[model samples]
Target: MTVGYILGYDPDTLREIVDPEQCAERLDEIGEQRSLPALLERVWLLKVLGRLDEALVLAEQAVRVARMGGTRKDLLRARVLHATILQNRGAFAAAIQELTTCAEEAEGQNWPLLAAFAYQHRGKVSYDAEDFVTARTDFKRALFLRQEGGAPEDQLESTLLAVDAAERRSRSSIAS
Candidate 1:
């Protein structure tokens, strides 16, 4: 669990790079001998490979380990990742609830980056449910937080898309 190597991989890199099964299996083996961060990485790799159920189990273990270790940051990350898995599985409402809790926790901890991520995820959940107004509000909040946190330009594109979608929904509502 080298922090530098872990932090070096941006979201685009994570989304683009597909590890071979042999690599993932090796990671899993190494993870079995390590701490929460290694386990979390194994779960994340599995999730990227579309093994949602397996990732969910590993995520649960991560949450449990984080809790036992009294590592709030790790717990929060595990919760968010698990919520993302749930969202991918079509459990929108549950994902929203988890993200909402995560957002509140981030706010309490003064972690604007985490709050922005949680709000962004919450907005996606709202968009999936066709609640454009709520989605727009969440997106706006996420955008503001991201800007304050100095997030990358590509990250800002999600806010742009959310705003565009919300405006389209608003126009259609007006026309109808």
Candidate 2:
């Protein structure tokens, strides 16, 4: 699990060297061992590598395992990752729904960072759906939480970009 976390967090470097298939295989092995954290990390890595289909499959499997193990946290994480995979596959509405669930769950747990991430993704989904107002609201919430959490500069930049994009879309709509 530690190894998976290390690898997943360094996806930029890992993606440059690790094969998707190898990562997927490792995820399968980790899943077989019922290592929830490892499974989550692998799903994240797979998503970063653009292996959405594989990630979705693994995410579903992780959810099933979480359910059977009665691990609510793992279930939530798996659902969130599943939503990410769906988003990558262009299933925006489904992704939004999943992210909504994640946001609610994270909020319940007082996990600000998780809630922020869910909101950020939900905002992106709304943007894709051409709902600029909602996107802007969600992005603002995400940006606020991220800033409050002292996220890295790069993360703040990305959140700012989402906010800017949403604002631009809203302005364009007003002009039209």
Candidate 3:
């Protein structure tokens, strides 16, 4: 939320769409760097670049490494990224399952921001699957969690947009 640098890049600007050339440049810069942050950044880059298979492989590795050497939060973050790659790959059920667990764990740990992220991504997966009602519910929860967690304005606005989209879809589906 602080718009910090990851591998010399601001992740917020590149979240949804990464410039392929920039991504390639970063990958080149990250050459032979197998650190956790480097691996995670690589996973994000590969994912946005439509290299889902490679992303998944790296994501799984990130999870393993986090489990072995990182904090609990690190493991959860790695799992979330892994689940996101699954969501991107059309594995809706698996993604939802993983996100559900991640959300619960984050909530149990009183990590509202992380829970919001899980819920938001889960809602996106539901929306992609045409489960508009579930999407709306999840998005609303994410919005609430974001607000409660005092997230950045842009993050709250993003969740609001998602909630609005899901609500519209839900209404249209009901009308049909």
Best by lDDT: 3
Backbone clash count, each prediction separately = 0, 0, 0
Residue-wise lDDT of candidate 1 within 14-75, one digit each (tens)?
22234456546666577574488777777767666778898788888888888898478778
Candidates' TM-scores?
A: 0.74, 0.71, 0.88
Instruction: Give model 2's clash tally.
Output: 0
Off by over 4 Å in 1: 1-34, 169-176
Which is the better candidate, 2 or 3, if ranked by lDDT? 3
lDDT string for model 3 (8-113, tens) is: 2232221363367877778778876788898888888788788999999999999999999999898988998999899889999999999999999999999999
lDDT of 2: 0.74
Clashes of 3: 0
Worst 10 residues of 3 by lDDT: 5-14
Computed on alpha carbons, the lDDT of every model, listed in order, comes to 0.74, 0.74, 0.83
- Model 1: lDDT to the true structure: 0.74
lDDT value, residue 158 of candidate 1? 54
TM for candidate 1 is 0.74
Task: Point out the higher-scoring one by TM-score: 1 or 2.
Answer: 1
